[model samples]
Target: MDDIAAHAALIAARRPRDARLRRVGVSRAGTPLWLLSLGRGARQALVVAGPHANEPVGGATVLRLAERVLADPRLTEGADATWNLLLCLDPDGLRRNEGWLTGPYTLGRYFRHFFRPGFREQPEWLPDGAAAAALPETRALLRLQDELKPFFQCSLHGVDVGGGFVELTRDLPGLDRRMAYAAARLGIPRELGPYDTLYWPRLGPAVYRIPPPRPRDLAAAITEAAVESTWYHPHRHGTVTAVVEAPMWGVAAVQDGSPPADRDAVLHAVSDALRHDTRVLKRLLARVRPHLGGTPDAARLLAPVDDYLLVCPGLADAWDPDTADPGRPLPALTAGHLTALGIAGRRIAVRTAGLLHQLVTGAGRDPSGALPELDGLIDAGCAAYRDDSGARWIPVARQAEYQARVVLAAFELAGRHGARARSGEPDWGTQAAVPMHRE
Candidate 1:
């Protein structure tokens, strides 16, 4: 974080008049959250990086984007949007993940060092109580939102493995295609089938309309109440929020939308893989539960594992062939679907193992003898992905470039239309009438 602060200071110094670095809020761990403001235009755009600490690609993207705009004024010369870049929203979590920041960029190192906060700890998805007592970081973002009411907002994100995709809060006609083109220009493969998002309305290839809040029950209602996503900023300020997702590693299968020859086999295999991973984690959690004391950090560490156990069964059930409707034929399962499922299973397993390893080792005692099993699990899970010959490491620079281009595309679209008030719930079926511009 000191390095990030120093870098931001240097950038601000370069353009003393136009660029200003301000401390927005302090992280839960007391690290200062800094926001770099650049340009002076009629509209405002907010670019957030490192929302999920494990996804560090956005951190690099933020730096590249700030530099790009500074180097070439023409990039945003006529675009009437002032750019506000938040380098890392969750600095505390990012610090936990610094182990692999300076890395060999291999899958083993990535998973071994990975750390993601539980849903409750995340600023964007804070529960109602948590939101009421928002983390300093969350408070800072709220203050920024109120202050800027940005016309366009983008939260940069990346997957550990998969093809590239984008999620939009408001559909800007042609923007998805343009963003896909930008990513393709950088040689990033587009995710054509289900990857992380399922059931989301696809605007175009690799482009998805983020589903609106729909709480089904008490639990869902609480979860919905906690969703303070920048995506929802559209409701308050008519902001068009776009989330750009790239991948640290690329899998060719994620780019293939063709249905697999053995659809039932693929479904069964994916479901079994997830169920197996969930069972492994559940057993490990049971072992570790007695050791974990009632502390915020302990809860935070356990949350992901607990949540996974709760959610994975339902996900697995959805894919179970016996559960499918007899009258309605199962949707054609793509090779990408099978590949994504396998990757998701490996990801959950490794992440659960990594977090549990931290808890066990940090407990200062190991009476349960779970450490050996955890170490083995971590190694095996990582090797499962790393040893795959089909997986290819994606360079950070290339990923950053792809993200930057998407940001530019959003800016261009915004500038062409300009900010306009959006009334009522957004009609998902139609393109938003508001114009978007670049910063």
Candidate 2:
């Protein structure tokens, strides 16, 4: 079969025994957008694919859930149990998502290579006023949701390295119980549980807003600035809907090249977490914000991005170093350095620094111990800068490169710890335990 046919077949094979496959639309790049539906098609459940590209995990998860739902004869037995699963909503974004989609399964390697935040360089970011009014993918989703009016409209997304957690629209209601249950079952950190901005109850899940898009009105000097705006979830059409974020750190398993069983063990643990809590999740979905046609003021929704920019060492004196400043630049920071900086800031950085310190001090630290931390620093730094690479205060891209260097050090530490751990002389202090410099 040709590539298109092959893709279709993969979706078909993965579909449950009674589901049907249909082409939803063509991607901007001309690739096909497909939809998988099961049951009687009443549109009671809807799972939308995210912007695709660098993060196909959301699409993959949707597909995986579809397969499992179809296979479970008990749950899918009802005629009224229908779902609309959009596969590859943004094929244009997905085409560029090669490495992570096809690469080896390691979070560290995935972190080093997968880069998509600076979407200006990306093709899919091109929907101008005309395209925005009717981008092929966007239009299709809009029309479908209008017609189906699904009970749950979940836009799937994967969070980056800095942190991982689940989110729900504050206006939509709480799935805290479901989320907490899943995290515990998956063995994900409890601290990673659901959270939200106390100020804007309407922004939905805090995780969905993670490394949120750079605010559009920031200083022009920053190259990697994010454009912050509330997205339109079709379910917001009084359909009782919102987005679902499954952070990568929460899903993908990593090790120092451990056996497949070990990796699968971790993946399944997460999968089970989501699966077991489905009933609780169903209960939570009954209360998303009722759609109000008018959109909210962007400015009111977004605190100005200027506050988050990271300043360079030169600006160090400018920013009262005594106050915890997200924008202050750290020329060459390691995980240890981040912890030290955090220690200096005291309480503000303690949460993140403690997590880093724990991983570094693990008895059998993975060979890529630094990988996650380095990813966190880069994420926090960029987030702090709101992606402004040109900010005079700091050169974010350069700082990012320097942050990568810290990741390399952590990698070496991980390798050393892994070697010793395998040999049964795991030393959590010297090899595994790297302390945060206090005072």
Candidate 3:
């Protein structure tokens, strides 16, 4: 079976009873793109799916939730009910990155293999204008969303090789609580914060921004939803919104070295936070459902807060702030920004090229080279692993892959010429790391 059918079968096999499943679109190869719907209530519901090609869990989670909603008929009863659920929004990216979707060989491998930074220079993620301009998968989703006018919409995505962070359309004061709960319930511990240290004037609320693309194209416009989801179809009865992002697997892995007591303490704290936060959000959402007359909240449910907490500290740093501006054209990256990203299509492709050379050619340090500072970052990140694992030497083969990529990229960025000469193409056969299964 193809990727979609395999996923669809997984959903069907494990899916709850009341959920409805159907094909929302077809692939370029004429594959049927499926969507699962749960809950029958007329109240506006959600369009939650996996947005990034690399992160399939969100779509899985949404399908799972639909099953749950279908089984629990009372979930949408009375004034609290919302709209009908919309299934996985984008299957194309999912299909494209199906290798990672197979199962976790290593989380780090999953990220580096699909290392499509959000910047213009990022060949992987940016896509050719034709594909980016709204892949058949994306356009079909927009059409469905615009026609249905759901209450709320969320896309599941992830960013590995960085810190954990959550991107929300609007600030939810208690999101920290919900996140803490997810971590605590899952037995992981990692603080979430801004991705980058810099800020922009107009996009004041964001932590970091990617640089602009040089030849601005329609794909850029599609990414920048002006008034949230409303930009897609201004005349729609209600708004259509999105939160494009990647999931951070950092939350559940904080117990490697803690005393049993300390580990429990962190878990308990996160659990307690989640419990309260979930309750608050459920209540808040319950209140909003009736107001929209069965329409999704779109952008209405989010409450802006100046002191919003992030799920990961380094979420925003990967891409420069200047590039993220939908308003500005993608920038012509200076040799500097390219130098910063190392390899895998970020800045500094040259340096990263050199590192691959060393790995492939088995070379040593070059005389006139400036190695990437990624080594220092990797060292620091190693410290983090040790701290979290209590030096238990948890099998971080997954993390090792991530470290390898970082090291490889940095070495290349330092302009190690001899190494660069011998760099071979990346091997895409490796599997992505699955999240660790903890008891």
TM-score for candidate 3: 0.47
Please give, for residues 81-155, the per-residue lDDT of candidate 2 as tens digits. Answer: 576677666665555345445556443334333433222222223323213544666666666766776544555
- Who wins the TM-score comparison? 1
The local lDDT score (0 to 100) that residue 398 gets in candidate 1 is: 94
Q: Which ten residues in a row have the lowest lDDT in candidate 2?
A: 300-309
Determine which window of 10 residues in candidate 3 has minimal summed lDDT: 304-313
- The reply for model 1, stretches above 4 Å from the true place, is 129-133, 216-228, 292-296, 324-332, 387-389, 419-439
By lDDT rank, best first, the candidates go 1, 2, 3
Better lDDT candidate (1, 2): 1
For model 2, state the Cα shift of residue 24 in Å.
Answer: 1.2
As a whole number from 0 to 100, the lDDT of residue 436 in candidate 1 is: 21
Off by over 4 Å in 3: 1-17, 78-87, 115-134, 171-173, 188-191, 196-248, 251-439
lDDT of 1 by residue, 219-298 (tens): 34322331445457444566777888888888777777776788778778778877887887788888888987743378
TM-score of each prediction: 0.88, 0.48, 0.47
What is the Å distance of residue 219 in model 3 from its true position?
12
The digit string of per-residue lDDT tens for model 3 on 102-178 reads: 55644323432332212222112223432343445545665566556653444444444232233332222333344
**Candidate 2 Cα errors over 4 Å, as ranges:** 1-17, 73-79, 105-108, 117-134, 170-174, 190-199, 202-236, 250-439
